[model samples]
Target: MKVRITIMPQAAVLDPAGVATAHALEHLGLHGVSSLRIGKLIELDIEGATEEELHQACRDLLSNPVMEDYCLEVIS
Candidate 1:
Protein backbone atom coordinates (compact mmCIF):
# COMPACT_ATOMS: atom_id res chain seq x y z
CA MET A 1 0.00 0.00 0.00
CA LYS A 2 1.01 3.60 -0.58
CA VAL A 3 0.42 6.25 2.02
CA ARG A 4 1.05 9.96 2.16
CA ILE A 5 1.49 11.80 5.44
CA THR A 6 0.99 15.52 5.74
CA ILE A 7 2.62 17.05 8.79
CA MET A 8 2.20 20.65 9.82
CA PRO A 9 3.05 22.71 12.87
CA GLN A 10 0.35 23.72 15.30
CA ALA A 11 -0.78 27.33 15.22
CA ALA A 12 0.60 27.95 18.72
CA VAL A 13 4.15 26.99 17.70
CA LEU A 14 6.59 29.47 16.19
CA ASP A 15 7.78 28.64 12.70
CA PRO A 16 11.04 30.49 12.21
CA ALA A 17 11.95 28.84 8.93
CA GLY A 18 8.58 29.59 7.43
CA VAL A 19 8.90 33.19 8.49
CA ALA A 20 12.36 33.49 6.92
CA THR A 21 11.12 32.08 3.64
CA ALA A 22 8.19 34.46 3.60
CA HIS A 23 10.54 37.37 4.02
CA ALA A 24 12.74 36.07 1.22
CA LEU A 25 9.75 36.02 -1.07
CA GLU A 26 8.93 39.61 -0.19
CA HIS A 27 12.47 40.59 -1.17
CA LEU A 28 11.90 38.91 -4.52
CA GLY A 29 9.01 41.32 -5.20
CA LEU A 30 6.30 38.95 -4.06
CA HIS A 31 3.86 40.95 -2.01
CA GLY A 32 0.35 40.92 -0.55
CA VAL A 33 0.95 37.61 1.18
CA SER A 34 0.17 38.12 4.83
CA SER A 35 1.29 34.79 6.24
CA LEU A 36 3.10 31.57 5.53
CA ARG A 37 3.47 28.18 7.15
CA ILE A 38 5.86 25.47 6.05
CA GLY A 39 5.10 21.78 6.47
CA LYS A 40 6.30 18.35 5.43
CA LEU A 41 4.94 15.53 3.28
CA ILE A 42 6.13 11.99 3.79
CA GLU A 43 5.17 9.24 1.34
CA LEU A 44 5.58 5.64 2.28
CA ASP A 45 5.09 2.32 0.56
CA ILE A 46 4.41 -0.50 2.93
CA GLU A 47 3.47 -4.05 2.12
CA GLY A 48 0.39 -5.53 3.69
CA ALA A 49 -0.49 -3.61 6.81
CA THR A 50 -3.48 -3.19 9.11
CA GLU A 51 -5.15 0.12 9.92
CA GLU A 52 -3.67 0.05 13.43
CA GLU A 53 -0.16 -0.33 12.04
CA LEU A 54 -0.64 2.72 9.86
CA HIS A 55 -1.75 4.79 12.78
CA GLN A 56 1.11 3.53 14.90
CA ALA A 57 3.63 4.50 12.26
CA CYS A 58 2.61 8.10 12.52
CA ARG A 59 2.29 8.07 16.31
CA ASP A 60 5.53 6.24 17.04
CA LEU A 61 7.88 7.55 14.36
CA LEU A 62 6.52 9.60 11.48
CA SER A 63 5.40 12.65 13.42
CA ASN A 64 5.73 14.47 16.73
CA PRO A 65 2.27 14.81 18.26
CA VAL A 66 3.43 17.48 20.71
CA MET A 67 3.79 20.30 18.18
CA GLU A 68 2.57 19.01 14.87
CA ASP A 69 -0.59 17.53 13.37
CA TYR A 70 -0.73 14.91 10.67
CA CYS A 71 -3.22 13.42 8.25
CA LEU A 72 -2.76 10.03 6.68
CA GLU A 73 -4.00 9.12 3.22
CA VAL A 74 -3.86 5.69 1.77
CA ILE A 75 -3.18 6.08 -1.94
CA SER A 76 -3.28 2.49 -2.96
Candidate 2:
Protein backbone atom coordinates (compact mmCIF):
# COMPACT_ATOMS: atom_id res chain seq x y z
CA MET A 1 0.00 0.00 0.00
CA LYS A 2 0.98 3.58 -0.54
CA VAL A 3 0.64 6.13 2.21
CA ARG A 4 0.85 9.88 2.02
CA ILE A 5 1.68 11.99 5.08
CA THR A 6 1.21 15.72 5.20
CA ILE A 7 2.88 17.54 8.06
CA MET A 8 1.87 21.12 8.67
CA PRO A 9 2.53 23.75 11.27
CA GLN A 10 -0.08 24.16 13.93
CA ALA A 11 -2.46 27.07 13.76
CA ALA A 12 -1.10 28.84 16.83
CA VAL A 13 2.55 28.52 15.79
CA LEU A 14 4.62 30.97 13.80
CA ASP A 15 6.08 29.73 10.51
CA PRO A 16 9.21 31.77 9.91
CA ALA A 17 10.10 29.95 6.71
CA GLY A 18 6.70 30.70 5.22
CA VAL A 19 6.95 34.32 6.21
CA ALA A 20 10.36 34.58 4.60
CA THR A 21 9.06 33.09 1.39
CA ALA A 22 6.23 35.56 1.28
CA HIS A 23 8.61 38.43 1.72
CA ALA A 24 10.85 37.08 -1.01
CA LEU A 25 7.92 36.75 -3.37
CA GLU A 26 6.92 40.33 -2.70
CA HIS A 27 10.46 41.47 -3.43
CA LEU A 28 10.36 39.53 -6.71
CA GLY A 29 7.31 41.58 -7.84
CA LEU A 30 4.73 38.88 -7.32
CA HIS A 31 1.68 40.96 -6.60
CA GLY A 32 -1.30 40.16 -4.42
CA VAL A 33 0.25 37.15 -2.74
CA SER A 34 -1.14 37.71 0.71
CA SER A 35 0.03 34.70 2.65
CA LEU A 36 2.31 31.71 2.33
CA ARG A 37 2.59 28.60 4.47
CA ILE A 38 5.10 25.80 4.02
CA GLY A 39 4.60 22.19 4.87
CA LYS A 40 5.95 18.73 4.17
CA LEU A 41 4.59 15.88 2.12
CA ILE A 42 5.95 12.40 2.69
CA GLU A 43 5.06 9.34 0.68
CA LEU A 44 5.83 5.83 1.76
CA ASP A 45 5.17 2.25 0.77
CA ILE A 46 4.40 -0.26 3.46
CA GLU A 47 3.29 -3.84 3.66
CA GLY A 48 0.88 -5.41 6.18
CA ALA A 49 -0.13 -2.16 7.82
CA THR A 50 -3.72 -1.04 8.06
CA GLU A 51 -5.07 2.52 7.96
CA GLU A 52 -5.26 2.73 11.74
CA GLU A 53 -1.66 1.62 12.02
CA LEU A 54 -0.57 4.26 9.58
CA HIS A 55 -2.40 6.92 11.53
CA GLN A 56 -0.62 5.89 14.68
CA ALA A 57 2.67 6.03 12.89
CA CYS A 58 1.95 9.61 11.89
CA ARG A 59 0.98 10.53 15.43
CA ASP A 60 4.10 9.00 16.84
CA LEU A 61 6.81 9.87 14.36
CA LEU A 62 5.63 12.21 11.63
CA SER A 63 4.24 15.02 13.75
CA ASN A 64 5.22 17.05 16.77
CA PRO A 65 2.43 17.43 19.26
CA VAL A 66 3.32 20.93 20.39
CA MET A 67 3.73 22.81 17.12
CA GLU A 68 2.90 20.46 14.27
CA ASP A 69 0.02 18.43 12.95
CA TYR A 70 -0.28 15.65 10.41
CA CYS A 71 -2.76 13.69 8.36
CA LEU A 72 -2.30 10.42 6.54
CA GLU A 73 -4.09 8.92 3.58
CA VAL A 74 -3.83 5.43 2.21
CA ILE A 75 -3.89 4.61 -1.49
CA SER A 76 -3.87 1.34 -3.26
Best by lDDT: 1
C-alpha TM-scores of all predictions: 0.92, 0.91
Looking at model 2, residue 74 earns an lDDT score of 78
Model 2 vs. true fold: TM: 0.91
lDDT score, residue 67, model 2? 88
| Candidate 1 pairs with clashing backbones | none
Clashes of 2: 0
| Candidate 2 error regions (>4 Å) | none
In model 1, the Cα lDDT at residue 8 comes to 93
lDDT string for model 1 (7-33, tens) is: 999889999999999999999999977
TM-score of 1: 0.92
On TM-score, the leading prediction is: 1
Model 2, residue 22: displacement in angstroms? 0.5
Superposition error at 27 for model 2 (Å): 1.2
